[model samples]
Target: MILRTSRLDLREMTEDDLPALRAILQDAETMTAYEGAFDEEMVQAWLHRMRDRYRDDGFGMWAVVLRESGEMIGQCGPTVQHILDEDVLEVGYLFNRAHWHRGYATEAAAAVRDHVFRALGADRLFAQVRDMNVASMNVAIRLGMTVRGRFVKNYRGVDMPHLAFAIDAPPTGREHGVSAAPPERRRER
Candidate 1:
């Protein structure tokens, strides 16, 4: 496992994970922020891009799996993002609808936040949340990020207004300025 939480595992996604990824990416309800569900071709391209990211940057969106059942519940991690003309490392999370409202997004993301800070040598981390995605915004907030700016993102032929949320890595790890606790263990990169 790349990183571990009390109830989850964050690791590289493989070709075998396509079906699990489809269950998350192809569901309309789960992909609302993405401008709707992805078709087969889009899903394939998404996987290929992530694989490329892993090879080139050593990290990308990872499979968030339930430790107890070994089931892939979501995708969450850092990716190279261009927000407001500057390339930044942004953490993102998307889960199956069945896993919604369960704190998994926050948990997985917190682990990733900690991992990126400790392992990736990142001084600041970001999350670009679509303006209307309150659920995702909340996850970013719980990760201790505050709105830094705003920008418009064109994706899937839609021009989306997004909020840029960010936080600097804290030396104490408890300075997140939010109530949610970081996972007990997220040691591996």
Candidate 2:
């Protein structure tokens, strides 16, 4: 499935995307905000795992490509995280250093949120961002998610502070400054 925003085209992962994904994941600067850098083999395995996720779950990370140049910038979408207990669907994203600060992550993430709510009928969507990753936290906020809670997340065997943000259900008419009409029985003639 392809999802398009004003500045990006989000599509499923392909074997051809392995190289780009590897480069992004292996960059120390980029991966520093995450667990750590991944080896080439690990990167390939991650690609395969993501592909499998799409087949089994019907939704997974999407490759964010530049619409005009067709360049694969990074990935953003939903993933089931088994943390703090049971499973939870979390919105995650990663971008190459060059693409940072361009609002690509925010744009792509908003598209994914809409797809999850409008298409997948998800009741809520959440994100787990590391405490020091201020940039990622900003992206989550821009998506209209409020901080739900905090927990200790073990990254590379090191316990780190993590924040959870979530959006529950779609906005109502009142929230959007519009009045909802009553049912036919309650409507006036």
Candidate 3:
């Protein structure tokens, strides 16, 4: 599936994206928020896992591409992550360190948030942000999510604490009220 934002195109990832994925996933600076950088085999496994997710769940992290140049910058999209002992739809993302601080993450994330609510009809969406990942936390906040709580997960033998951020769908006409529809059309008859 291909989703578009003004500056990016989020599409299903394939083995073809391996090179770009490697640049980001294997960079220590880029993967610093997580356990550590991934190796070549780990990167391959990551792509395979995303492929499996698309087959089983119909949605998974997607390749984040530059629409104009057709470059694969990174990956972002929805994936079912186990959180608080239940399956939750999570808006997961990782970008090339070169692409950071350009509003790309927030832009791509807001698009995915809408896709989850409008296209997939999911009631709620989440972003599990590592506590120290302030950049990601800011992106989640920009997407209108609030920190629901905190939890910890063991990654590579380290207990990493994370914050769960979430947002719910707007009720009925509330979704398209005012701004989504012309004011004249929104006015009561």
Give the number of colliding residue pairs in candidate 1: 0
lDDT-based ranking, best first?
1, 3, 2
lDDT of 1 at 23: 98
Whole-model lDDT, model 2: 0.86
Q: Write the per-residue lDDT of candidate 3 for residues 1-189, one digit (tens) a residue.
A: 479999999989988899999999999989987778999999998999999999998989999998889999878999998776679999998999998989988888899999999999999999999999999999999999999888998887899999999999876565555356656776854
lDDT of each: 0.92, 0.86, 0.90
Q: Quickly count the clashes in candidate 2.
A: 0
lDDT (10s digit) by residue, model 2, range 44-138: 88888889999999778889999989999999989888645658888899998888998999999999888888888788889888879999999
Candidate 1 lDDT by residue in tens digits, 1-189: 788998999999999999999998999988898889999999999999999999999999999999999999999989999987899999989998998898999999999999999899898999999999999999999999999999999997889999999989987545575333455544331
Best by TM-score: 3
Model 3 stretches with alpha carbons more than 4 Å out: 174-189
Model 1 TM-score relative to the real fold: 0.90
| Alpha carbon RMSD to native, model 1 | 6.7
Query: Candidate 2, residue 23: CA error in Å?
Result: 1.9
